[model samples]
Every structure is written in structure tokens, then in C-alpha cells.
Target: MLFRQLEYFVALARERHFARAAAACYVSQPALSEAIRKLEHELGVPLVRRGRTFEGLTPEGERLVLWARRILADRDALEHEVRALRTGLTGELRIGVIPAASATVTQLTDPFCTEHPLVRIRVETSLRSRDIVDRIRRFELDAGIIYADGVDTDGLTSTPLYQERHVLVAGSELLAGSTAAISWAEALDLRMCLLPKGMRGRQLIDDALATRGLVAAPQLESDSVATLLEHARTGRWACIVPRPWVSTLGPTAEVRVFDLVDPVVTAHIALVTTAAEPASVLTTALTGTARETDFATVDRRQR
Candidate 1:
């Protein structure tokens, strides 16, 4: 019933441990337990399936946790709005970013911070597109930078941020005789280090190769784009990455960057936020920032 009780319950659901949840809430174990008990009594439902150790939430608790998250999110948004009306935006804006788009997130965050100096920004850069979308839906992230293609956007608002074109990067020795552009099949033939199949970038690459009846059998697979690039730098493997990343994280020496051709693949990168009505103030501000951001400079440089 009380907001504090809801906080404790949500924390418990998240931590899945009574002691850790109590620690997170900065309250004693007994206090947290008593609050949840009171909340359960008020709702007339057994929220937790308990034993000596922490058991999982009951069915009713599982459903109510979703509502509890929404309520807490709404409460924070209300506080942010009221505080902003008097003192400018002053809360943290939590953003989840897909790793392929990690280098480019600063394009939005830098300006957002400059405009609202009091607002704090937290960027989680290692998420996949699906993970970012899931977190946004769960009210865990205010916005996300993710690949726009092949992701379920139902109940979400997406603003196109930029187009990402894949490029092949490898040590000079590995690409000693390669041309300015290489076909997907040729790239696949090299000793390659590629993102795992679960990543959106990898999926796009796989789809492109599938058109040629070819599959990427990389020498190594990693979830991190940086890791793939690192392996490429060793002269033993080649990796494919977004062309824009070449300007930022691409190696300056010992590497040859080739445009991926013979069916060049491009994916739309987008900023996504939940489609909930009465959008949070931070989400509105971030959406506006996304609209006004000038990616032309980066685009031109990448060209």
C-alpha cells in the first residue's frame, strides 16, 4: 500500500534474496519482510512463497511486480517533472545501448548533458538490441539506442538515428591483396572473428550471407564488437563492423578497412522509448534531442 512497501517488494523481486533486497533498500531484513507482509495483507494475497531461504514470488506476486514497477516509475517521473518545473531536469536518464552503436551514443548524450547540466546520464553499452528493447518495456531504461531492423517495435516509439553499414576490418597482412570492397563470401572465407549469432549485427550479416547460400564459420565468435576488432588487429582474423565505428574505435594502423559489398548490408539504428501515454519528462527531452542531433558530421567523416 505504501510506496516504501512497494519499493521493498520490487527490490525483493529483483534481487530474489531477502537479505540482498533488504540491503538494497537500506533497511533491515525484518523491516523489509514486515513491509511485504503488510503489503500482502493490504492486497489480500500471498505475494511470496516463503521458506527458510528465499523462494520465488507466487503467481499473484509475479503479476503485481509489473504493476509495482510501473507505479514506482510513475512516482519518479512525477517527482522529476515537479523538480524540473522549478530547477530544470535533475534526475538520472538511464539509457541502454547496443554494443555496435556504443561509440555513437555520445552524439545524443553529450548534448543532452550540456543542455540539462543537472541531469545525470547512465549508459549501459553492452546490451544487445533485444535486451535493450526488453529493458525499455520493463521500465528499466528511459531510452535505448538499438538496431531498428528485425526488432519487434509494437508498443514502442522509434526515431531513426542513423544508417549503419557493415565493413570488413583486418590487419594489413590478412587483407594484403584485398580491394576497396570485398564480397560477403570472400570475407567469410578469411580467418574471421565475428559477433555471435544472437547479436542483431551478426544476424544481419548472417541474413546477408544466407542470400548467397554461404554461412559464416568464423575462427572465433564473441559478443563484444571490441573483442572482435581486437582479434582482427592480431593479423590472424578479420571482422565486420559498422562503418561509422571505423571513425571512432577502428584501428589507425596495421588494419585495412574494406566496404562490405556483393550485397552490401545496412541496418537502421534508432532511438526507442516505450509508447506509454504521459511519457516521462526525461524520455520526452531525450526524444527531442534525438530529433535534433546532427549525425551529418559523423556520416560525412565515415564516407
Candidate 2:
């Protein structure tokens, strides 16, 4: 019934582990468990299932969690609006950025902080694009930097910040040290490490490769771009990465971005927010700046 309880419930649902959820909410485990119990009693339905640890949500709990996000989002919006009137636009903005495009997350933040010095900005890097979309939908994220059209985004709106082209990168040994653009089929013949199969970006890569009637043999796989980049740096393997992201490695990190052949895959990177919710001023400004900002300038700083 209380907004605080809803926030707590949402956190527990996300963290799944009561102890960790309590830590995240800065409360003790018992207090969180008691609050959730009281909330269930008041609602006349359990919001979480019992187990040795948090196993999963029940059907009803899952449904309520969705509704809770909307209610809590509305409540937070009211508080943000009131505070904006009291002061200039100010509040915390949480954003999620996918790994490939994660470097661009700060582009919108610098200008935002300069203009609204009182605002706080928080960003979490997610390798999976769907995770970014899910967090944005749950109101856990104010906005996200994700692929332009990768997500269904039926209930959300986004503005393209830039177009990202895919690169088939290999070590000098793979391309004989010099650079050679590899076809999807040719790339498949080499050792490759890609984002985990479950990741949305991975799915995009798969679908693109499927068009060539080729499925890559991935001997090493990870959901972390940092790991993928690290492996590629050793020149022992190759990876498919987004363009512009290539320069993020250290100077010793020798790598090259090669254009894909025949069917080149390109996706627009966009700043996205839920259209169904009222956005905080910080969220609005971040979204606005992302679409208008010069990423070339910002990306240099990220490097």
C-alpha cells in the first residue's frame, strides 16, 4: 500500500534474493521480509514465493510486479514534478547501456550535469540489449542506450543517436596481420567469440549470419564485451563488434574493423525511454541531448 513498500517489492523481485534485495534497499533482511509479508497481507495476495532462497515469482506476483512498476513510476513522477517546481529540474536518472554502445552513455551525461549541476546520473552497462529494454520497461531505468531497431519497443519511443555498422575483426594472424573483410561464411570458418546466445545483440548477429546460411562456431563465448575485446586483443581469435567501438582498446590493443561482405549488418543506436510513463526532467534532457549531441566529440572523450 505504501510507495516505499512498492519500491521494496520491486527491488526484491529484481534481485530475487531477499538478503541482496535488502542490502540494495539499505535495510536489514528481516525488515524487508516483514514489509513484504505485511504488503502481502494488505493486498490479500502473496507477491513473492517461498523457498530456500528467492526461487521465482508466482503467476500473481509476476502480474502484480508489472502493475507495481506503473504505480511506483507514477508516484515517483509526482515527487519529481513537485521537486522540479521547488527547484529547477532535478532528480536522479538511471540509465542502462548495452556493451557495444556503452561507451556512448556519457555523451548525454556531461551536458546534462553541466546544465543541471544538482542532478545525479547513474548508468549500468548491460551486454544484453533485452536487459536494457526490460529495465526501462520496469521503471528501473529512466532510459537506455540500445540498438536502434533491435527491440520490439512497441510501448516505448526512441531517437537514433547514430548508425552503428558491424565489423568482422580478426587478429593479424587471422587476416595475416593486415586487414581483410571477411564474409559471414568466411568468418564462420575461423574461431570466434560472440555475445552469449541469449543476448539480443547475439540474436541480431545470428539472424544476420543466418541470411548467409551460415552459423558461426563459437568456441569461446561471453556476455561481456570487455572479455570479448580482451580475447580479440591477443590476436588469438576474432569477434564481431560494432563500429566506432573498436578504438576503445589500448594502443597495444591491436585490432581492425572490417566491413562485412554481401549483406552488411547496420543498426542505429538510439536513446530510448518508455512512452507509457511520465519521464523525469533529467530523463527528458538526457534523451534530448542524445539525439542532438555530437557523438564523435563525446566518443573521443570515452576513448
lDDT (10s digit) by residue, model 2, range 89-126: 77788888888777566667888888888788888887
Model 1 C-alpha lDDT per residue in residues 64-183, reported as the tens digit of each score:
999999999999999999999999999999999998888788899999999999999999998888888988877888899988888898999999998888899888887688789988
At residue 258, candidate 1 shows an lDDT of: 91
Q: Which residue segments of model 1 deviate by more than 4 Å?
A: none
In Å, residue 69's CA in model 1 sits off its true spot by 0.9
Candidate 2 shows a clash count of 1
* Runs with alpha carbons beyond 4 Å of true place in candidate 2: 15-23, 28-64, 176-182, 185-189, 296-303
Query: What does candidate 1 score in Cα RMSD to the true structure?
Result: 1.6
lDDT of 2 at 146: 83
Q: lDDT value for candidate 1?
A: 0.88
Choose the strongest candidate by TM-score: 1
Q: How high is each candidate's TM-score?
A: 0.95, 0.79
Q: Write down the TM-score for model 1.
A: 0.95
lDDT, each prediction: 0.88, 0.78
